[model samples]
Target: MASSIHDLARHLNISIGTVSRALNGRADVNADTRQRVLE
Candidate 1:
């Protein structure tokens, strides 16, 4: 099953907001961190 954003965040050990921001391509997230999430 595909994971929801909340599940993904929990699994990744990061905040839900960070996952959301990274997925949305927001500028506030660090580039490396965003890349790690996407991978």
Candidate 2:
């Protein structure tokens, strides 16, 4: 699967690591951002 994690992180002003963890079902992701990313 090709994910836009880097782009999403940049637009959201967060780190790529955060985006990665979030998509992988980590507990540290911000709810709102995660939702947007998923969408």
Candidate 3:
């Protein structure tokens, strides 16, 4: 089953805002972190 941002964030042990930013490709997010999110 697919997970939502909240679930993903919890799984990754990161903040929901971080997940949102990473998924959105926001410049504020770290490149490595963004790549992890994309994958």
Candidate 4:
């Protein structure tokens, strides 16, 4: 099952907006950050 942005942020110890942007494929999110989320 996929986790929500809030769950991801808490799990990854990052900000919610950061997780949200990564998940939505926002340009603000770096490749490494996005890759971390995917993994």
RMSD of each: 0.9, 2.4, 0.9, 1.4
lDDT per residue as tens, model 3, 1-39: 989999988888889999999988799999888887778
Give all candidates' CA lDDT scores.
Answer: 0.91, 0.82, 0.89, 0.87
User: 1-39, model 1: which lDDT tens digit per residue?
Assistant: 988999989888999999999999999999988987898
Candidate 2: stretches off by over 4 Å: 1-3
Error of 4 at 26 (Å): 0.6
TM-score of each: 0.83, 0.62, 0.84, 0.75
Clashing pairs in 4: none
Error of 4 at 33 (Å): 0.8
What's the best-to-worst order under TM-score?
3, 1, 4, 2
What is candidate 1's CA lDDT for residue 24? Answer: 99
lDDT of 4 by residue, 1-39 (tens): 968788888988889988888888899998998998878
| Top-scoring candidate (lDDT) | 1
Off by over 4 Å in 4: none
Off by over 4 Å in 1: none
Q: Which model, 2 or 3, shows the larger lDDT?
A: 3
